[model samples]
Target: MAADELKLENQVCFALYAASRAVTSLYRPALDALGLTYPQYLVMLVLWERGPVLVKELGQALDLDSGTLSPLLKRLEAAGLVRRQRCAEDERAVRVYPTDEGGALRDRAMSVPRKLSGATGMGLAELEALRENLVRLTEEITAQQD
Candidate 1:
């Protein structure tokens, strides 16, 4: 076969995109149980790791925009998992804090990582390697975007 860098099958970006969608599909049912989508689950992970963060910070962490995040936050709020309030010092900025229900949901969410590990049937070392590779690729992509 002739070399063609522009070919879709030769593209790393397409591979990454396909893999990401597959991985998110795996999480769909797991997240649905918690009444959250994959993106919402990511938001929960960020907030759980760092409590009471500003909306902008959450958006940055998730690499999403306010336009996309605002509606998701509203859904999370309606589910009683999170609360959004205007920051005291900066009224223009909104802060997102987890509710007691949200905090409790973390306990339920904790099982997900382990369950997914089992479902994937990949050992810890292999999983770590995959994570490291993905992180490196993500950093490279972000650097290119800059």
Candidate 2:
């Protein structure tokens, strides 16, 4: 019974992990045309919504650490989609700002949500409910860690 409980098929984390990967894969082809990866798209989304943000704030917002974010930001900078510079007020802090080209990408990315929704074949309300539930679950798990 204990072994049965330990099976991969029975783990919610495994289910979530697999589902996350599968959902990300759906974005690959679409993101490919935009010259972006899933992580990069996520960064762009944050920048698009928040304007210039400190690197630490960006990491906190995205639930990422500098080790993971640094390389990704470097790549985006190289692509001319974003710029990273030391904050004048606090030289120790770095701020990331999206370029004009990055802002322009938003128009091209408008169809991504529609494409993903079509692929899921789920209605907006249903998806919203699911997202809310997942957000609650994530909050609960993170709360336990604190």
Go through the candidates in order and give each one's C-alpha lDDT. Answer: 0.90, 0.92
lDDT of 2 by residue, 44-118 (tens): 999989999998998899899999999999999999999999989998999999999999999999888777778
Per-residue error for 125 in candidate 2, Å, reads 2.2
Give per-residue lDDT, candidate 1, residue 69: 95
Cα TM-score per model: 0.89, 0.91
Alpha-carbon runs more than 4 Å astray in model 1: 1-11
**Model 2 TM-score on a 0 to 1 scale:** 0.91
Model 1 TM-score is 0.89
Provide the lowest-lDDT 10-residue window in model 2: 1-10
Which is the leading candidate under TM-score? 2
Q: Tell me the RMSD of model 2 versus the true structure.
A: 1.8
Candidate with the greatest lDDT versus the true structure: 2
Candidate 1 local lDDT, residue 46: 93
lDDT at 91, model 1: 91
What RMSD, rounded to one decimal, does every model reach?
Answer: 1.9, 1.8
